[model samples]
Target: MIAKWIKFQILDTERQDWTRGYDTARRYFDREGSLDVPYEHIENAYPLGRWLSDQRRAFRAGTMSSTRADELEELGMVWDTADTAFAENLAAARAYYAQAGTLAAPRHATALDKPVGQWLTNLRRPNGLGKDPERTARRAEQLAAIDPDWNPGQLGWTVDWQRHYTGLTALLEAGGTLDGITPGVTYRGDDIGRWLARQARDWTRPNPEQQRRLGKVGVKPAARPQKTAARTNTKARAAKGSDAFTRGVTALAQYIQREKKTVVGRHHVEELPDGTSVRLGVFLSNQKSRRDRLTEQQLAALAELGYHWTQ
Candidate 1:
């Protein structure tokens, strides 16, 4: 009889603990509107996140009671966190597509306050969607519904090319004309004019599907500029001489000013006062290796910036 009484007391304590966890979870649900709490989250000094994780583990292990599971589900407890995360990211992607008209987001792009760019990039990797055939197909279908050309590589074009094309499409849809998109013109951070000029210069490069899409948007290949051979050669030499040197110096100066340091990563790009960008680190490295070829003016510029290869 004493042993029975002790067992009853232990069961009562377990019930109280479970009830307390449930109450805390309900409070969290009311505040956050979802039970998708971070695994390390705390609520009012309680380890609510760990408690929720424990509950999920218990449910999966078939140790949790049906009544308890039902109560938690009432508060929007999602057992499959992978599915929940995928759904949320899909919504964010859709939001991005609605605004950008394409899913070819840059690696640093964000949408709906989510890192949708990285998410899409990860999805593009092999087996990133999942190993399950059915699930992969479902996810692919959903993405395709948002933008048929979301995966540009599968369609024989680069993501950057698709990004620019989409930007052009967005411009056209907004009633922008082709003539107004000059070299300096930009849309959604894309240099529309420069890309159009390249497409015109190499009109035969893009596949038939790409050509059809361009045609559908009323974009025709433009005529190449006619230049005299002597003039072109002179300009080319000049472009390689003073202009390139000045641009590199300008970029290095800008980088030093902005970062308050001379150290630059190999991939760093510095924007110049003229709105153009230069790969300053690569330029500096190249100049340092070819210091023997630098003119007096170029050496003076580097000295002024406190950049000395000998040091």
Candidate 2:
């Protein structure tokens, strides 16, 4: 199955070169974002082709190494050498290259393209490229001297010490097990503690659903009624309206009486055995709106209140 997942491919070097040339030619066709001159014409007119041909000839003739050495000498480097200084420099260069390769390509390329002497100079400075054995030893000594009673794993100690000594907050933030410290765990500092406290506050605070549940559980206080126009006044106004308005009001009333039955509306009235009828208006008013359905608890409460069906 894994073998089926993998596929092999090969690059056509000649085709690649041809495609590159084609792209370069296309760039000249639309000179909005690039150079305006036609590269193909320039290649044909200038000694570019001849130069490339000569380079290929030299490569095939095994004269490329000698040519490269002469070019290096022109840059002020003594290529022909077997001395200790030469050997040491070569070793340092190789080590530097290895270290640079571990970095991102852009940074690596920048370091690699720097002058050899300049790069070597950078490696010797206090905050330089080369590793300092003496500094490493001194750090170890300082760590040992850092109040033997001060546990490195303690919350404030590591952060405070690292800040005072190295100012490497990034390294401290990217937590890991240091010497005498537990792995996959971080010390809780003031910031972390505050974060945890805020999270606790958020968790303890009631959400909408939780508030509704708490209301149901009789733990929360009853919600205050919204200030609304009296239903009696509304009904009185509807009754005194024009013919069209009266018809609309009648139709709405009929819709509420008929269609409201399909849903568990509070309009469902009940009569008691003592010949007393309870107005569903009270239950309806207690709800969000008369259109809202009654819960089982509300229904049971209505029943306990001596309510019976009354059409």
Candidate 3:
């Protein structure tokens, strides 16, 4: 493909080389930003191709002398390695990223003619080349120290700790510690990072659908209390109280004062003929039992309040 274009591609019509080809290429090749002559020499061959692929690698990458140009002119054609090398390196780059467990190409990888490893190494920041096993071991030691404080199998995991967590905070909620933490059931940090990029329009832009999905798997906001149900007049409630009903109300009020929100596994509400309603929000955890039973302490409290216990 390039063979056909190579002849005219190097004509240097305005004598402009890599400079003036693209603004970025201009700054990179020559900070001065324009090739005075645009003729026979442009260094840093790597940027030449990816930065500007069509112009026979911008013609600056393999600048031919006028003598060589005239000779080629006499011969009516000249072969160039620019395309062959680009194809080989393009294939190489694909293989490199696939094996490296990454999906991004190096930002600075502006050329396709060099060894993929050369420019690729420039992008492995914060964890260069994955070469140090000792570093990994030390990080593991740090992670192992965090207590696996919460388990999420029952009553669902509390998103309280992670409500406002950034990536770092979220990581802590997931593993309890940064270093000793387990990889997710099926993902790692790199995997999550990639997935996150796709989930949003941009890092800051909002996407409602993505937000809903992330709320489930990534960052969850703590649940706020649902609105309490309507109740009958106070006089109605007071007159309908059986001894059990009276005790339950006092116990529930005390429970609410102690904990802002009631935590209940088994909840019950009853309405009397006079329109009095009594509700019981138990304290036993749903995570621990399918059936709700009062604790010994709770049973004692009710008994003291003149409520008898029965199956």
Q: lDDT winner among the candidates?
A: 1
Instruction: Report, for every candidate in turn, its global Cα lDDT versus the true structure.
Output: 0.78, 0.33, 0.37
**Shift of residue 127 alpha carbon in model 3, Å:** 29
- Across 8-113, the per-residue lDDT of candidate 1 in tens digits comes to 8988788888888889999989987988775546788887867887787788889999999999999999897565467667877888888888998887789768
lDDT of 3: 0.37
Candidate maximizing TM-score: 1
Q: How many angstroms is residue 247 displaced in model 2 relative to the true structure, after the best TM-score fit?
A: 99
* Alpha carbon lDDT at 150, candidate 1: 78
Query: After TM-score superposition, what is the CA distance of residue 174 in candidate 1 from its true location, in Å?
Result: 2.0
- The parts of candidate 2 lying over 4 Å away from their true place are 1-64, 78-168, 171-311
